[model samples]
Target: MKRHPRRSVPATLTALVLLAACALVAVVTIQMLLGETPWIRYDTVAAALHGTRWTDTVTAIVGAAAVLLGLILVLAAIIPGKPVVLPLRGDLDSGASRRSYRSTLRVAASAVDGVSDARVKLKPRTIAATVTTGRTTIDGLADAVRRSVEERLDQIDPAVRPTVRVKIRAVRKAS
Candidate 1:
């Protein structure tokens, strides 16, 4: 089954900060109800809020921070999540990782005659391969690699059929 890639860092940080703030408020409230010394005095808070310069500076900083945080949250909600796996033939959960697809394509391309090495890049809608060939004739090498890679892709039958692009590079002969 295709799973959405996780946005862990922001989510984790937000959760931790919220939990810490809640714990602090809870502790302070409990101390106040018990008539114990609070971590922060009410007078200090009143003074800070009543002061013109400090209050204005704090308000501006908080406003800017809130705006930035809102933008981040909006962006996180709007951006499309990337797929964790590419669906393949068979059971509903059957699929392949992108790395597996690239490896399969690279092996397939490298199997072509005269191909010394192969590098493959798999995208959502395209499969690109670069092959290094030996002294063999350059004619039809790219086509052969493309055909081989396409055949492999067809066998896998991924959710999206990617167009194949082959690039051939010849190895330099030793002097």
Candidate 2:
């Protein structure tokens, strides 16, 4: 089971940059077609670049910036984002996503007596649960959550088993 995070952010950024460049080119071409003076003075710019030396500070800085931008874009495209699913141990190799696993752990934590709500954070090495309850005294609540979560983990048997850590919080109902 393999899963990767969405690349919307990088894709959107690249699209915006390309859109700006394409718009500039289109506007310049249209102005030239209409025989109007374009905002960009191509002759002056060409002459400036033609006279600029590779060792010149301005030319060197521009080159460095362009290379840096190109490198960043390349890396973003090539790098794989974090997986959406946590791989499991057993056979079948069906992609069991972390969301479903977290939800399962949440159900276990909430099943414990006195637990009003449960929030779970799952990492490769640790599974943390924050439990909210109406009971003023939270004695044994954390242990119960840990036991419940562990039981759920035993059932799921993920490839990387995370230790269960539970925190209990008390809340009073306001009328």
**Tens-place lDDT digits, model 1, residues 92-165:** 66888767778988999999999999999876788889999885468898999999988998899987688999
- Tens digits of per-residue lDDT, candidate 2, 1-175, equal 6577877887898899999999998998899889999878789889988999988999889999999988987888788766698778877786578789889999999999999999999765898999999987777889989999999888888887788888878896445
| RMSD in order of candidates | 3.2, 4.1
Error of 1 at 146 (Å): 0.9
Worst 10 residues of 1 by lDDT: 48-57
TM-score of 1: 0.78
Model 1 CA deviation exceeding 4 Å by range: 52-58, 89-94, 133-137, 173-175
